[model samples]
Target: MMKFRHLRYFVAVAEELNFTHAAERLNMAQPPLSQQTKQMEDDLGTILIERGSRPMRLTRAGGAMLEHATRIW
Candidate 1:
């Protein structure tokens, strides 16, 4: 069920490293953005953001995803 829009969502969050900021940048509500990102992780079967972290960070898989996503853009 992955889509190009999913990658766009991931890229925004990955770049901001914060869901709220990413949501703002995308001009969408935070909840949907979070849900979409969660769906992305679910679809990919890998953890992207380390939600437990204070400042938040991308997991190794997330880092790799970001790299490829940017190129695809």
Candidate 2:
């Protein structure tokens, strides 16, 4: 089961594309935000964020998730 908190975290990170910025926006710390994002990806069984990129990039699955998440809110 997918949690809304995870979805919200994903949406935040997806929109900002920066862990620090997303964390700031969420009023949390970067490490935990990054961890949650990774956990979410793991739980979903897909790589949502491309960690190798400088600013970070979203996988196709992440993009689709963002699209759906935006519509949800």
Candidate 3:
């Protein structure tokens, strides 16, 4: 089951595309934010963001998930 915390983390990271900024927005550390995102991907069984890429882009699945998440929230 997916958690709301995971969704929140994903949304922050998705919007910022920078772990540091996202973490700051969440008032947490970058590592935890990254870990939460990893856990979310593991639960969903797919890659979300393309880490280490310039101007990070979401995977197709990530894009779809983001859209749904937005509506659900």
Q: Best candidate, lDDT-wise?
A: 1
Of 2 and 3, the candidate ahead on TM-score is: 3
Q: How far is candidate 3 from the true structure (C-alpha RMSD, Å)?
A: 0.8
How far in Å is the alpha carbon of 15 misplaced in model 2? 0.6
**Alpha-carbon RMSD, each predicted model:** 0.5, 1.0, 0.8
Give the alpha-carbon lDDT of every model.
0.95, 0.90, 0.89
Off by over 4 Å in 3: none
List model 1 lDDT by residue over 1-73, tens digit each.
8899999999999999999999999999999999999999999999999998979899999999999999997
lDDT of 3 by residue, 16-66 (tens): 888889999999999989988999999999999999798888999998888
The residue-by-residue lDDT of candidate 2 on 27-68, one tens digit each, is 999999888888888888999989999868999999999999
Q: Order the candidates by TM-score, highest first — what do you get? A: 1, 3, 2
Per-residue lDDT of 3 in model 1: 92
What TM-score does model 2 achieve against the real structure?
0.92
The lDDT of model 1 is: 0.95
Candidate 3: residue 36 Cα off by (Å): 0.7
Best by TM-score: 1
